[model samples]
Target: MSAPLASLPPRRLSWQFLRLVTPYWKSANKWQVRGYTLALLLFTLAQVALAIWMNYWSRELFDALEDKSLNDLLMQVGTFVLIFILTMAVTALHMQVKRWLQLDWRRWLTAKVLDQWMTRGHHYQLQLVGGEHDNPDGRIAEDIRIVTESSIGLVHSLVYSLLIFGSFVDILLTVTGSATFPGTAFMVPGYMVILAFAYAGAGTVFGLLLGRPLITATNKLQTAEADFRFGLGRSRSNSESIALMHGEDIERQNAKTFFARLSQRWNRQTLGYLGIVSFSSGYGALLPVFPILLMAPQYIAGGMTLGVLMQAAQAFQKLTSALSWPIDNLGELAHCRASIQRVLSLYNDMQVLDEQASEPQEHRISVAQSTQHELVLRDLCIANPDGLILLEGFNQVVRRGEHVLIAGDPTVTISLFKVVAGLWPWGHGEVWLPEGPAISFLPQRPFLPHASLQSVLSYPQPAEHFTQAAMHHALECAGIAWLAPRLTELDSWDRVLPLRAQQRLGFARLFLQQPAWVFIEEATDAFDPKGEEGMMDMLYRELPNATLLTISFHTGLERHYQRKLLLNRPAQDKYLTCSTSECSLTTAPVTPVVTAAD
Candidate 1:
């Protein structure tokens, strides 16, 4: 029976996002975040000091030049040299500190998100509604990289802007005070504030107006590109099938059409980017002149010295940096936000299903009673993802050494194995397998990780764990001895091997591992009847004492088993089950336990 988790889940983005991000701080390198933060704090404080001293140095050096005292000139020169040295050292240290911090943060974030992707079985369950709903592979591998890099860069730029603003604001106010219109104190605080806000708002609004569309466009384009790539992959992997069907021209035409869409979207995005750059670059070059124009009157009236004039110019440049923080980060910030929304949406959708398990499955599976049977699913009930009732009160028992065959419905058997393997969580009723029994499941599509042949042969166990003799023996038993010579030659053996060969390898591992119980799905679905019989013979010979449970609708293998069970989708509420004609294949219905917390 499948695990039941039927409930709507909470998906407030802010809270869920925080829950997602919290795991990074709990990683093994947590102390590194602390150490880097301390260094950044010290470096930031030092940077502020240096910036302030430079402002004072500007005025003092000009004063010394006006006085023309050799002693004062020498003193100013030496002080300037020392200030330069200190500034260089501080900047270098800050750079190194930030580099490590950025990398540390990225590593922590990627690892945490990746582990979550693999842990919840969301990666597999996500496959059902399969037109690129969520690619955990892309999310973990690429999206995390973008988010981490963009986030760190944004933080650094914001911090630097804050320090620059703090260092120059006082100097700016003093320089502006020296200027006057006749007699009344010149007041331009309001003008400066208004300008800052206007500049930031314009860039933000413009960037969003032009850039937001690109994010969504790029995401769509990426999916299309992946589809096109996957089509090519299919061509490569199923060359024999494609060739037999004479689909070369058909596939070529389809691929050309897919690439055409990809090209169309990319071209539009390029134009959008060009439009943004045209507007932004115009603003950048014109910005430096505005500060000088605002302060021109002070220098002309002799209200400020050359040093004070330079300081005022620097201040205006500094002000632009402060006002333009968002503008500078607009691209990265947009991409980061887009990625956040995407990842957040996926996490929410995946989690939303099992939030509270409020809706119980039609067939309630539970432990009616322990019968000292090898396996017992009491009053088991399950439904397809589309609400099609698959199995109801699907009672079954496997004796200690009996080989049981579950036949009749192809869809039913496949769904049942998924539920029993503890991979599918959409069904109800408790499936009781003795806790101590070792259960090994082989699905129709088995996982083939990228590694050496030896590593592939000894999957779930590292390559080093298996002896050379054992490696050859296992491959030979699986009739995959063609790989024996390449045991040390590492590659993607799973993809390289034929589906039949891979299943043979899976069976070989099953036999070699000698699990207490073996649950076989349509692992041999792609193979001929003879091949299926051959593999079953090998399985029995290898694990004569092991309890064998098989799911097959072929009926050809029916002769191999003593106990046979069948299932059908009778209705939305009732799933059909029949063991033999006279029995009517029915069992007592189970009452599922549900609590408020459940």
Candidate 2:
């Protein structure tokens, strides 16, 4: 689980944020990114310089009005026009540069995240080890956008505020001068500067108190939003199954439940925003008036000119606004914080998986590569994530070109299947995979990505990699040759094709790749007995030299394999025996291998 954003100290969060973004700055495109960043900062500085010019221009225009000089007023008006044009141009350029940086940063970060999530089957392992990283699709798509765009925006505003404070503080001090105590001889220098800091500091304290609830509320709202999106996506992906099962009522109820949770979170977030919005409105309304009222005494007493008075007020507003950056941006800061924490949580969980693989524990099944041309499982014990034993003290050695059928309990066989593929590790054992090409595991319902038929057939490889003739031949062999005419057409093949056709397409892929080793988990179960026999015959005939391991509930499959391994529970009477290297039953083996050739 991820720690709540509110509980994380500012320094710790800053460190995490730095770790997240530092790579991009030092990446191959560093010079280009840095060049654009520098341009943005320069444009911002130019904006401040124009603002300073406008301040002095305002004072001159007011002084001209007091004197009733048409010529001086005209000159000041022309200066105002010039300043306005320059400000608009600078502002536009700054926005373009900032947007460029945001898009580039987002693209790089999204690619990095996608690579981490997809590489080495981390996506599958993440599911096995559950964490707060639910709906990674949303995190990758939405949260990362928010993180990049909002982070750059926040940084720009923060830097702008600091510059404004530096530029305006001096102007405010000079215009307002010092103030003496009402009854004492003590005089405070830069009285308006001191007052601005005090005002901003007090407002920040109150705003923090009012807006603290927003952090937790925003986190909950984002989570609810992701959950709702995930629910809808799952339903859409499984629309065919749901419609066939007549599960519309259940699905509709699930959607309503998801929305209800979202609504609850939305209302809580609204309540959290109420205090901050109300306080901000009042604070902003008083900003232009507060400084004038304080300095009006001197203006009325003829000690300060109208121009100086107006200048002092504007300067005071700018300085106070700069000092209040945190209070002003509390809501957006909360939003950006939530996204950052969510992204970091997912990244940390994936890192933990990497650590687990690097440092193997005694309780885990260690899978390693070997030079031998055979798959070896020694003293194997498979367990579910909950530590419940499924298969214990199992040993097997499958040489190259052997046809082996793994039968019996589906749970045990499936767990062993994943263990061999290095996707499951919740047990004690050693699995040595021969050094060769990758082992292809064809599931019962193969994944058919929404793409051209040719691309779908040659998934994880480019469609251009295979010749058209080869693709057509493979399709004909798998009985999906009718799909060859539409190979160039793109569509959701999973939805368009039936179960049998899709299963056949899976076989067509195996034919095209012609792997040395194949593991099939009910890939042909959807077929009738005759169809199943046909697929088995085609598989053996097409790949005579390839090794094969299959898991199926159907009978008569033994005739196709040289050996059959049966998974069964150990006898209760035979006590369990354990050791550091192996845990086995005192009696015979729990898994009995039958020689089909006998």
Candidate 3:
């Protein structure tokens, strides 16, 4: 399930990259995006044209100085002003166009990945089918920015280099002309052109050799950084529990461990950078002087004028610089590749999940909807993520308006609740649900988002969806009517409210939703016996005809439900070993539901 996407073979990596990027080009705004891209390209072309004009302008100014003519110098000065104005305008416009395209592409890519990550239970499923996608938040937020911005910058530079190489190669050839060795009759044509290629070729080969280590180091460093961020984020999220357990010292150690790992990777990447930088320094220092020295012999011999010699040196430098693009950008290329790999890995794993879900498996759970107003579980079996059977050979049918109490091992009951809601799929069975209204599940701990109290009550629905009176009534029924006045105040309700108050808010949502079917999992555990009884009474008072299923260990809950079912574990302490294909039913007894009449 995991592979080094950064080390993928060039052809496969290109295909993967194209697969990711092609969607935006063909999206609904393709024409507008294309127009912007076209404008950027035109600006690039304009930049190259300006560079070529400046090359000739330099020749004229240098020649005028050599000729000692005031009129020619003045004429060249006017041309210089024209070139300066045009260069400034083109450079500024090119920057704007490039930024527009980069941001637009980044926005599209971010939205696309977010949709895949959040929709249709993919977020939950991704955790179950784990792979290299550890910190999805880091990948979406930081890595996407690097991929979009660096990619555009790299591509523009590459195109500019190619254009310069093409235009300047011919100029170097013409200016250098044919050369003969001092003592020989044999002459070499366009010798400077040949020398420029050899210089750039040698630099490119050595640059890549030295840069190989950098690519590996960069990928590892990025992963370490992401892990460190994830550790911090997790600690922040569970700060309340950590504080209550007095686990701050353990958390400090964990943070130190994350940072130690990051520091080790940083040192390795620094070593990688050293080699490339040393070689680049020597190569850059020689570029300007190397061309002039070769042209020096011809200039001293009076075979070429100062104007032609200077122009020839300039042409040689431009041609070689164009060919040196790979050498100049080696580090940035490594960084960009690392980001692309992280993004592609997340995308590929999600795609694999989709593929697995589409193909049918013999022991896989199948969830279906029926027109009948009842829930049916046929030959149900529940297993944990490790393929160990927790509960098996279960069958149940709950009709509308039945109040059922489920008492069992906590793990088994929670898994059953998720199975019915279609959130846990690691079991074999058929779950036929009523088609009209969705089932509502309230877990042990309620999640209160940071928002207005009114919005908190109407979460997953608009605040305006419920009338003010209904909101107030729900609050009263849940025993938190004191919050009614603060419905408009925005705050972090989860942080400020106590566990009991948060539980009340959860029940208030159930009142607002008014679902036909409801499942509760120890949501009343925070309350005392009297408070729990009052909450139960309030539920029946508000929605007497609604079908209710409660999973709890509280003593008096049995009195509220007409039927009681007890889940019994086997005497054996070991888990039932089984594979998906040949899963055998566990003999763990499940006591049949007994009616209150019995």
Return the top candidate by TM-score: 2
Top candidate on lDDT is 2
| Candidate lDDT (C-alpha), each | 0.67, 0.87, 0.85
Show where candidate 3 strays beyond 4 Å. Answer: 2-6, 361-363, 568-598
lDDT of 1 at 433: 76
Predict model 1's lDDT versus the native.
0.67
RMSD of each: 7.2, 3.0, 2.8
| Model 2 per-residue lDDT tens digits across residues 1-598 | 3454446897998898788788998899899998999998999899889988988888898889998999999999899889989999999999999999999999999998888899767889888776767788899999999999999999999999999999999898788889888889999999889999998998899999999999889989999999999999999988999999999999999999999999999999999999989998999999999999999988998878889988888889889999999999999998999998888888777777776565544557899898999999988877666555677777789999999888877887888888998888777779999779978999889999999999999997999999999999999999888888998999998888889999999999999989999999989888999999998999988899999999988877778998788776544334444455555545654553333442
Candidate 1, residue 154: lDDT: 77
Single out the weakest 10-residue window by summed lDDT for candidate 1.
1-10
TM-score, structure 1 vs. true: 0.82
lDDT of 2: 0.87
TM-score of candidate 3 versus the correct structure, residues matched by position: 0.93
The C-alpha local distance difference test score for the whole of candidate 3 amounts to 0.85
Q: How many clashes does each candidate structure show, in the order listed?
A: 6, 0, 0
Candidate 1 RMSD computed on C-alpha atoms after optimal superposition onto the true structure: 7.2
Q: What is the lDDT of residue 275 in candidate 2?
A: 96
Which 10-residue span in candidate 3 carries the lowest summed lDDT? 589-598
lDDT, candidate 1, 168-276, per-residue tens: 6666766656333567887555344345457656876786676656655655655566567767776887776677799999989988998998898778667767767
